[model samples]
Target: MNITVFCSAYSLDDRYSAPAAEFARLLGTGGHTLVWGGSNAGLMGLLADQVKAAGGKLVGIQVELLKHKTYPGADELVLTRDLAERKAQLLARADAIVVLVGGLGTLDEITEVLELKKHGLHDKPVVLLDTEGFYTGMRVQLERMDAEGFLPRPLDQLIAFAETPAEVFTHLTTA
Candidate 1:
Protein backbone atom coordinates (compact mmCIF):
# COMPACT_ATOMS: atom_id res chain seq x y z
CA MET A 1 0.00 0.00 0.00
CA ASN A 2 1.08 3.59 -0.55
CA ILE A 3 0.97 5.27 2.88
CA THR A 4 1.14 9.01 2.96
CA VAL A 5 2.78 10.23 6.18
CA PHE A 6 2.22 13.74 7.42
CA CYS A 7 4.78 14.59 10.10
CA SER A 8 6.76 17.46 11.48
CA ALA A 9 8.83 19.27 8.85
CA TYR A 10 11.05 20.46 11.71
CA SER A 11 11.49 18.93 15.13
CA LEU A 12 14.18 19.30 17.80
CA ASP A 13 13.17 16.36 19.95
CA ASP A 14 14.30 12.81 19.42
CA ARG A 15 11.08 11.62 21.06
CA TYR A 16 9.22 12.04 17.80
CA SER A 17 12.03 11.01 15.43
CA ALA A 18 12.69 7.70 17.16
CA PRO A 19 9.21 6.29 16.57
CA ALA A 20 9.11 7.79 13.10
CA ALA A 21 12.29 5.89 12.23
CA GLU A 22 10.84 2.66 13.60
CA PHE A 23 7.60 3.19 11.70
CA ALA A 24 9.55 3.78 8.51
CA ARG A 25 11.54 0.62 9.06
CA LEU A 26 8.36 -1.38 9.46
CA LEU A 27 6.83 0.34 6.45
CA GLY A 28 9.77 -0.54 4.21
CA THR A 29 10.26 -4.09 5.47
CA GLY A 30 6.54 -4.72 5.28
CA GLY A 31 6.54 -3.87 1.54
CA HIS A 32 4.61 -0.64 1.86
CA THR A 33 5.42 2.55 -0.07
CA LEU A 34 5.90 5.94 1.60
CA VAL A 35 4.68 9.24 0.19
CA TRP A 36 5.62 12.46 1.98
CA GLY A 37 6.80 16.03 1.73
CA GLY A 38 10.19 16.37 0.07
CA SER A 39 12.45 17.63 2.82
CA ASN A 40 15.60 16.37 4.45
CA ALA A 41 14.81 17.83 7.82
CA GLY A 42 13.07 16.76 11.04
CA LEU A 43 10.95 13.64 11.22
CA MET A 44 10.44 13.72 7.48
CA GLY A 45 14.15 13.16 6.79
CA LEU A 46 14.56 10.57 9.50
CA LEU A 47 11.65 8.51 8.24
CA ALA A 48 12.74 8.81 4.62
CA ASP A 49 16.22 7.57 5.48
CA GLN A 50 14.88 4.49 7.23
CA VAL A 51 12.58 3.68 4.32
CA LYS A 52 15.51 3.86 1.88
CA ALA A 53 17.73 1.85 4.19
CA ALA A 54 15.07 -0.86 4.25
CA GLY A 55 14.85 -0.68 0.42
CA GLY A 56 11.31 0.67 0.24
CA LYS A 57 10.01 3.04 -2.41
CA LEU A 58 9.91 6.73 -1.48
CA VAL A 59 7.81 9.27 -3.35
CA GLY A 60 8.32 12.90 -2.49
CA ILE A 61 5.93 15.72 -3.36
CA GLN A 62 7.60 19.09 -3.24
CA VAL A 63 6.56 22.60 -4.08
CA GLU A 64 8.63 24.89 -6.26
CA LEU A 65 9.21 27.42 -3.51
CA LEU A 66 10.57 24.77 -1.19
CA LYS A 67 12.94 23.27 -3.72
CA HIS A 68 15.91 24.26 -1.60
CA LYS A 69 14.69 21.92 1.15
CA THR A 70 14.25 18.90 -1.07
CA TYR A 71 15.70 15.59 0.10
CA PRO A 72 18.18 14.07 -2.34
CA GLY A 73 17.51 10.33 -2.04
CA ALA A 74 13.82 9.95 -2.71
CA ASP A 75 13.08 7.18 -5.24
CA GLU A 76 10.99 9.69 -7.19
CA LEU A 77 10.61 13.42 -6.74
CA VAL A 78 7.52 15.24 -8.01
CA LEU A 79 7.60 18.98 -8.28
CA THR A 80 4.38 20.95 -7.83
CA ARG A 81 3.42 24.47 -8.82
CA ASP A 82 2.37 25.35 -5.27
CA LEU A 83 1.49 24.03 -1.81
CA ALA A 84 -2.10 23.36 -2.81
CA GLU A 85 -0.99 21.30 -5.78
CA ARG A 86 1.51 19.41 -3.67
CA LYS A 87 -1.16 18.60 -1.08
CA ALA A 88 -3.55 17.51 -3.80
CA GLN A 89 -1.02 15.08 -5.14
CA LEU A 90 -0.34 13.66 -1.70
CA LEU A 91 -4.03 13.02 -0.99
CA ALA A 92 -4.75 11.72 -4.49
CA ARG A 93 -1.98 9.13 -4.40
CA ALA A 94 -2.32 7.62 -0.94
CA ASP A 95 -4.17 4.43 -0.06
CA ALA A 96 -4.11 5.45 3.61
CA ILE A 97 -2.89 8.42 5.62
CA VAL A 98 -0.81 8.39 8.83
CA VAL A 99 -0.30 11.54 10.76
CA LEU A 100 2.52 11.86 13.30
CA VAL A 101 3.38 14.65 15.70
CA GLY A 102 3.71 18.00 13.91
CA GLY A 103 2.90 21.68 13.99
CA LEU A 104 0.44 23.86 12.11
CA GLY A 105 1.00 22.39 8.68
CA THR A 106 0.34 18.92 10.02
CA LEU A 107 -2.88 20.14 11.60
CA ASP A 108 -3.91 21.60 8.25
CA GLU A 109 -3.31 18.28 6.55
CA ILE A 110 -5.26 16.38 9.18
CA THR A 111 -8.28 18.70 9.11
CA GLU A 112 -8.40 18.74 5.33
CA VAL A 113 -8.19 14.98 5.13
CA LEU A 114 -10.83 14.56 7.80
CA GLU A 115 -13.10 17.01 6.02
CA LEU A 116 -12.66 15.13 2.80
CA LYS A 117 -13.47 11.85 4.47
CA LYS A 118 -16.45 13.34 6.31
CA HIS A 119 -17.95 14.47 3.05
CA GLY A 120 -17.58 10.98 1.55
CA LEU A 121 -15.12 12.26 -1.00
CA HIS A 122 -12.88 9.35 -0.10
CA ASP A 123 -13.10 6.21 1.98
CA LYS A 124 -9.40 5.85 2.65
CA PRO A 125 -8.46 5.11 6.26
CA VAL A 126 -6.92 8.01 8.15
CA VAL A 127 -5.02 7.31 11.36
CA LEU A 128 -3.47 9.70 13.78
CA LEU A 129 -0.37 8.48 15.55
CA ASP A 130 -0.87 10.02 18.96
CA THR A 131 2.79 9.89 19.82
CA GLU A 132 3.29 11.13 23.38
CA GLY A 133 -0.32 12.17 23.51
CA PHE A 134 0.47 14.97 21.10
CA TYR A 135 -3.05 14.97 19.78
CA THR A 136 -4.83 15.02 23.11
CA GLY A 137 -6.19 18.49 22.64
CA MET A 138 -7.27 17.84 19.10
CA ARG A 139 -9.00 14.65 20.13
CA VAL A 140 -10.92 16.51 22.77
CA GLN A 141 -11.97 19.09 20.25
CA LEU A 142 -13.14 16.41 17.82
CA GLU A 143 -15.23 14.83 20.53
CA ARG A 144 -16.76 18.19 21.24
CA MET A 145 -17.58 18.64 17.59
CA ASP A 146 -19.30 15.30 17.46
CA ALA A 147 -21.24 15.91 20.66
CA GLU A 148 -22.34 19.30 19.37
CA GLY A 149 -23.75 17.76 16.23
CA PHE A 150 -21.34 19.70 14.07
CA LEU A 151 -20.22 16.53 12.28
CA PRO A 152 -22.35 14.80 9.68
CA ARG A 153 -21.32 11.42 11.05
CA PRO A 154 -19.57 9.90 14.02
CA LEU A 155 -15.93 10.90 14.44
CA ASP A 156 -14.87 7.27 14.42
CA GLN A 157 -16.22 6.92 10.90
CA LEU A 158 -14.19 9.90 9.77
CA ILE A 159 -10.85 9.12 11.42
CA ALA A 160 -9.04 6.50 13.48
CA PHE A 161 -6.52 6.97 16.26
CA ALA A 162 -3.46 4.86 17.00
CA GLU A 163 -1.15 5.25 19.92
CA THR A 164 1.58 3.05 18.52
CA PRO A 165 3.12 2.04 15.20
CA ALA A 166 1.64 -1.42 15.61
CA GLU A 167 -1.85 -0.02 15.84
CA VAL A 168 -1.25 2.34 12.93
CA PHE A 169 -0.14 -0.44 10.60
CA THR A 170 -2.91 -2.72 11.77
CA HIS A 171 -5.48 -0.07 10.97
CA LEU A 172 -3.95 0.50 7.56
CA THR A 173 -3.89 -3.17 6.65
CA THR A 174 -7.42 -3.80 7.88
CA ALA A 175 -8.86 -0.54 6.66
Candidate 2:
Protein backbone atom coordinates (compact mmCIF):
# COMPACT_ATOMS: atom_id res chain seq x y z
CA MET A 1 0.00 0.00 0.00
CA ASN A 2 1.04 3.60 -0.61
CA ILE A 3 0.76 4.91 2.93
CA THR A 4 0.61 8.60 3.72
CA VAL A 5 1.92 9.02 7.24
CA PHE A 6 0.33 12.16 8.73
CA CYS A 7 2.58 12.92 11.66
CA SER A 8 3.40 15.90 13.87
CA ALA A 9 5.73 18.11 11.91
CA TYR A 10 7.11 19.49 15.16
CA SER A 11 9.31 16.76 16.60
CA LEU A 12 9.43 13.42 18.40
CA ASP A 13 10.68 12.16 21.72
CA ASP A 14 13.32 9.46 22.31
CA ARG A 15 10.59 7.13 23.44
CA TYR A 16 8.99 7.36 20.01
CA SER A 17 12.02 7.69 17.74
CA ALA A 18 13.16 4.07 17.92
CA PRO A 19 9.74 2.64 17.25
CA ALA A 20 8.98 5.13 14.52
CA ALA A 21 12.21 4.24 12.76
CA GLU A 22 11.47 0.56 13.28
CA PHE A 23 8.04 0.94 11.77
CA ALA A 24 9.53 2.65 8.74
CA ARG A 25 12.03 -0.16 8.38
CA LEU A 26 9.34 -2.80 8.66
CA LEU A 27 7.13 -1.02 6.14
CA GLY A 28 9.92 -1.00 3.57
CA THR A 29 10.75 -4.63 4.23
CA GLY A 30 7.13 -5.39 3.47
CA GLY A 31 7.39 -3.60 0.10
CA HIS A 32 5.18 -0.61 0.92
CA THR A 33 5.82 3.02 0.02
CA LEU A 34 5.48 6.03 2.30
CA VAL A 35 4.32 9.62 1.99
CA TRP A 36 4.79 12.34 4.57
CA GLY A 37 5.34 16.02 5.16
CA GLY A 38 8.66 17.03 3.68
CA SER A 39 11.06 18.27 6.30
CA ASN A 40 14.48 17.61 7.72
CA ALA A 41 13.52 18.42 11.28
CA GLY A 42 11.05 17.19 13.82
CA LEU A 43 9.45 13.75 13.87
CA MET A 44 8.57 14.15 10.23
CA GLY A 45 12.22 14.62 9.38
CA LEU A 46 13.34 11.74 11.55
CA LEU A 47 10.86 9.33 9.98
CA ALA A 48 11.77 10.41 6.46
CA ASP A 49 15.46 10.05 7.20
CA GLN A 50 15.14 6.67 8.87
CA VAL A 51 12.78 5.40 6.22
CA LYS A 52 15.32 6.21 3.53
CA ALA A 53 18.17 4.79 5.54
CA ALA A 54 16.16 1.60 5.89
CA GLY A 55 15.58 1.52 2.13
CA GLY A 56 12.00 2.71 2.21
CA LYS A 57 10.60 4.53 -0.81
CA LEU A 58 9.31 7.69 0.81
CA VAL A 59 7.89 10.83 -0.78
CA GLY A 60 7.37 14.22 0.84
CA ILE A 61 4.88 17.06 0.41
CA GLN A 62 5.46 20.56 1.64
CA VAL A 63 3.86 23.93 1.31
CA GLU A 64 6.22 26.40 -0.35
CA LEU A 65 6.26 28.97 2.43
CA LEU A 66 7.16 26.44 5.07
CA LYS A 67 9.63 24.69 2.83
CA HIS A 68 12.56 26.96 3.61
CA LYS A 69 11.84 27.23 7.32
CA THR A 70 10.80 23.60 7.82
CA TYR A 71 12.32 21.43 5.14
CA PRO A 72 16.06 21.59 5.18
CA GLY A 73 16.86 18.63 2.98
CA ALA A 74 13.92 16.53 1.84
CA ASP A 75 14.58 13.73 -0.64
CA GLU A 76 11.40 13.97 -2.66
CA LEU A 77 9.97 17.20 -1.41
CA VAL A 78 6.96 18.38 -3.34
CA LEU A 79 6.30 22.03 -2.68
CA THR A 80 2.68 23.13 -2.92
CA ARG A 81 0.99 26.51 -2.59
CA ASP A 82 -0.81 26.23 0.75
CA LEU A 83 -1.83 23.84 3.49
CA ALA A 84 -5.24 23.28 1.99
CA GLU A 85 -3.87 22.24 -1.37
CA ARG A 86 -1.26 20.07 0.22
CA LYS A 87 -3.83 18.24 2.33
CA ALA A 88 -6.20 17.82 -0.58
CA GLN A 89 -3.42 16.31 -2.62
CA LEU A 90 -2.55 13.91 0.16
CA LEU A 91 -6.15 12.82 0.58
CA ALA A 92 -6.51 12.23 -3.11
CA ARG A 93 -3.19 10.55 -3.69
CA ALA A 94 -2.70 8.20 -0.79
CA ASP A 95 -4.58 4.99 -0.11
CA ALA A 96 -4.19 4.78 3.64
CA ILE A 97 -3.40 7.27 6.42
CA VAL A 98 -1.56 6.98 9.72
CA VAL A 99 -0.83 9.68 12.29
CA LEU A 100 1.86 9.76 14.89
CA VAL A 101 2.24 12.21 17.82
CA GLY A 102 1.38 15.80 17.01
CA GLY A 103 -0.02 19.07 18.30
CA LEU A 104 -2.79 21.30 16.96
CA GLY A 105 -1.67 21.05 13.35
CA THR A 106 -1.63 17.31 13.50
CA LEU A 107 -4.96 17.21 15.24
CA ASP A 108 -6.49 19.46 12.64
CA GLU A 109 -5.10 17.44 9.75
CA ILE A 110 -6.19 14.07 11.06
CA THR A 111 -9.60 15.14 12.28
CA GLU A 112 -10.41 17.03 9.11
CA VAL A 113 -9.48 14.09 6.97
CA LEU A 114 -11.52 11.80 9.19
CA GLU A 115 -14.47 14.16 9.01
CA LEU A 116 -14.18 14.17 5.27
CA LYS A 117 -14.25 10.41 5.29
CA LYS A 118 -17.15 10.43 7.68
CA HIS A 119 -19.13 12.59 5.29
CA GLY A 120 -18.40 10.27 2.35
CA LEU A 121 -15.72 12.48 0.82
CA HIS A 122 -13.20 9.67 1.04
CA ASP A 123 -13.05 5.94 1.62
CA LYS A 124 -9.80 4.64 3.00
CA PRO A 125 -8.16 3.03 6.01
CA VAL A 126 -7.12 5.37 8.83
CA VAL A 127 -4.91 4.27 11.65
CA LEU A 128 -3.92 6.07 14.79
CA LEU A 129 -0.44 5.17 15.99
CA ASP A 130 -1.28 5.68 19.62
CA THR A 131 2.15 5.18 21.05
CA GLU A 132 2.08 5.13 24.85
CA GLY A 133 -1.66 5.72 24.81
CA PHE A 134 -1.22 9.25 23.55
CA TYR A 135 -4.74 9.36 22.21
CA THR A 136 -6.62 8.19 25.29
CA GLY A 137 -8.85 11.24 25.27
CA MET A 138 -9.88 10.68 21.68
CA ARG A 139 -10.67 7.07 22.38
CA VAL A 140 -12.73 8.06 25.38
CA GLN A 141 -14.63 10.53 23.29
CA LEU A 142 -15.26 7.87 20.70
CA GLU A 143 -16.81 5.67 23.35
CA ARG A 144 -18.80 8.59 24.63
CA MET A 145 -20.09 9.28 21.16
CA ASP A 146 -21.12 5.71 20.75
CA ALA A 147 -22.89 5.72 24.09
CA GLU A 148 -24.75 8.90 23.28
CA GLY A 149 -25.75 7.63 19.85
CA PHE A 150 -24.03 10.65 18.34
CA LEU A 151 -21.74 8.45 16.28
CA PRO A 152 -22.56 5.21 14.57
CA ARG A 153 -21.04 2.06 16.01
CA PRO A 154 -19.36 1.47 12.70
CA LEU A 155 -17.75 4.91 12.78
CA ASP A 156 -15.71 3.78 15.72
CA GLN A 157 -14.43 1.04 13.48
CA LEU A 158 -13.07 3.66 11.09
CA ILE A 159 -9.87 3.95 13.06
CA ALA A 160 -7.34 1.38 14.24
CA PHE A 161 -5.28 1.84 17.34
CA ALA A 162 -1.96 0.31 18.34
CA GLU A 163 0.22 1.11 21.32
CA THR A 164 3.53 0.54 19.63
CA PRO A 165 5.20 0.91 16.27
CA ALA A 166 5.69 -2.83 16.06
CA GLU A 167 2.01 -3.34 16.67
CA VAL A 168 1.20 -0.69 14.10
CA PHE A 169 3.34 -2.43 11.52
CA THR A 170 1.69 -5.75 12.25
CA HIS A 171 -1.79 -4.30 12.19
CA LEU A 172 -1.26 -2.51 8.90
CA THR A 173 0.21 -5.62 7.33
CA THR A 174 -2.38 -8.03 8.66
CA ALA A 175 -5.24 -5.62 8.11
Q: TM-score of every model? A: 0.97, 0.89
| Model 1, residue 137: C-alpha shift (Å) | 0.3
lDDT of 1 by residue, 1-175 (tens): 9999999989658777887888899999988889999888888888899999997889999899988989999989999999788888999989999999999988898899899889999988999999889999999999999999999989988888998888899888787
Which residues of candidate 2, in runs, are more than 4 Å off?
Answer: 69-75
lDDT of 1 at 150: 99
Worst 10 residues of 2 by lDDT: 68-77
Model 2, span 78-127: residue lDDT tens: 77899998888777768788888878878888988877876778777788
Error of 2 at 8 (Å): 1.9
Task: Find the candidate with the highest TM-score and give its number.
Answer: 1
